[model samples]
Target: MSYSYTIQQHVYSFPDLKSVLAKASPFRTGDALSGLAAESNMERVAAQFVLSEIALKDFLNEAFIPYEEDEVTRLIMDTHDNVAFQEISGFTVGGLRNWLLSHEVDSQKLAKIAKALTPEMVAAVSKLMRNQDLISVAQKCEVITQFRNTIGKKGHLSVRLQPNHPTDDLRGVAASIVDGLLYGSGDAVIGINPVTDSVDIVGDQLKMMDEIRQRFDIPTQICVLCHLTTSLELLDKSPVDLVFQSIGGTEKTNASFGINLSMLQEAYEGTLQLNRGTLGNNLMYFETGQGSSLSANAHWGVDQQTCETRAYAVARHFNPLLVNSVVGFIGPEYLYDGKQITRAGLEDHFCGKLMGLPMGMDVCYTNHAEADQDDMDNLLTLLGVAGCNFIMGVPGSDDVMLNYQSTSFHDALYVRKVLNKKPAPEFETWLHNMGILDDTGNRLTIEPSHRLLKNL
Candidate 1:
């Protein structure tokens, strides 16, 4: 399927799509209502346009256009006690889209409906939305902000120290943590991904991280991103601050990872049984991405992006501390290149935030993919603007075991500096007290003391 149009001597083809959005003007482009009907692929474009129009905030006096209400609208109205219709009487698809964009609608209310609304409806209204506008709605959306109280301390951004060693070598893991802490990273959680799935090995790694945290008197959490079953076995034997798992769009894909909602609840209950983290702090850390559904042959005709968003529904049910979309790690068959990866990253962050999860981006790429640091830099900036909760911090942006390049510890610092953000309050105070960061939470110029440099 394709839709083509010419504008200013440029011919643009909307591939895998079937409709073209017409520019808004005083004169009608066409009289047929069918002309405005959107195809699945046109949803993004239409949504973008509606968001852009709403950002203008000039639609108050204009009569909202009319369209038939479908199951999505009916469900939304019923769930919310018809407040949806009360807010926008005589609502049309176009009108509802505009109402969502307009300032008149409560962002929390909009988010509620947005989450309940079908993906097709969301795509239809949000097709033409600008990134900034998307960010605006996300800021007030309920789901995007729900986990805020439970994740980071003092409302500061957080970072995870994901030190992965090919052999699960405890010493190498210690070196990486030393590097991350010296650079003032891992304020979110000092987590490691063990190469071996053995419960004993992962249990040992968790003990190592706990030992380091206690040794340095650092105020931070610890986690080992082992399979859930391994994590479950180690619960009583180790100090697992947060249980880590990777979720996908389908039950089968999640099962392949040895997880499902029931297992997740079991982990949740088990974490509470151990009572490792601070009071009120959430104990689950989840990672997701597009294409996992298609990768597992369970997409069921839905686009990868949409399927990925639905996974957020599953995630929020558990009230996780961190839910990250490792946007570019899956490779090009799902997201073809840097541009595609960048767009999906932004979309995933936006959707996750809208759904009320503390979102982070593992801004990264594989060696064979059509992406680079420049692309990651671009995504890093966008996700920051979108109010991302935290991000991954490797020593030099390269994970030797995972064999991929992601944002480095320094990259997190740069974004914090550029955006005037700080790490979680408790960690920030620790850094300042230790002279690793200044009062403003900026990295200090103090030389690496022998205390930090000696072992390495």
Candidate 2:
């Protein structure tokens, strides 16, 4: 029998219902699970199964019975047991805070305790502690700060060439890349978000990016921000260095983008099967934003910022190479104007960092919104100080296709100069070798290069 589910306007079909059901069972809790359940007509009842809104046996009886015991279910049961152990350990919130402050409890112990406590319990403790103290503890948690090799090994920064054009024109894309490279960007990846959703168009763009990378010998990855399934389909036929998707806070919101955790996992695993990425490199790249959940009516009454952080939890599961919070992209309904946008950007950066994501900020705003480059500059400076992993390098911070202004290639240079940071090691070598940057990493005069000038 065929099973299909619709959430928002997207419909997901399960050709093999039992296999799909079993694969989804492990993630049958948390926002990711709830969001999937809510969108799935076949497993709509599974929405309540999260947090024991319904009993497991009852859920199985109402839903389909699994042939095998789910390891994820067993892990959940084990975590509950651990939570019970922590409750009786006699550490009050104040006591825990004091202990953390005094360094009497190390990060490992704190991490263990954090795992045992519910998210609410942690939030209550967080309320009583200083922000600096919380940040310090967060840094210590192993799960919160992952170092992936795609961008930098560790202690190095990166940037992506987001050369968005209105029509996915190869010349337009190359012009942006040339501009970005001349200004010393493209350490993370030279990725493009094709305006058209046509898989063929996206595939052609990916091929073009690959040809450029090979021709220039630039040490960077490439991505075309198509739907995850579309990207998966093109994996064998194209040079897809990373699988990209935009995920959000709620199931319905994610559905609006035609994404779910299962689909994300499929894309990630498919990339692995192809061995397309560098050895020991992560394959997934995701973009997220505040207000996306509320925009899609999937906020579940939660505040936009908290819901945004919950999206990080989903990102953490996949160990993506890059998880960027497009902080100001959603617009005024959730974050009204520049002040709100700046605050949300900083908060999202902090929250994503604490959750151990290779966090980047889009540092962007739409023309229709009450924002400008000055507002983005303020946030960009702060994020640089906060050790952001990457940022977008578009021409003049303007996306001709998306019609939004973001950080420009010059802006990236400014931030790196101010922070005394360099690009990824490989890309840095390429820049020096090309004479675009000198031995001291200073930008050389591009005017002498007629080829680049001619393009300009």
Q: Among these predicted structures, which one has the highest lDDT?
A: 1
Tens-digit per-residue lDDT, 1-456, candidate 1: 334454456454544221222222111112012133233334434433433333111222221111132222232223332343344445544565556567866655764554344333333334445566566665555432222123432235678888888888998988898878877788767888777789889888888888778877787778888888888888777877788899875566676676777888899898877766554557788999877866776544445665576577667667788889998888766666788787777777777766567778799888877889999998888777667788999989999999999999999888888888788766777787777888766767767564666654
Model 2, global lDDT? 0.64
TM-score each candidate: 0.78, 0.73
TM-score: which candidate is best? 1
TM-score for predicted model 1 compared with the true structure: 0.78
Give the Cα lDDT of each candidate.
0.66, 0.64
Clashes of each: 18, 3
Which ten contiguous residues of candidate 2 have the minimum total lDDT? 47-56
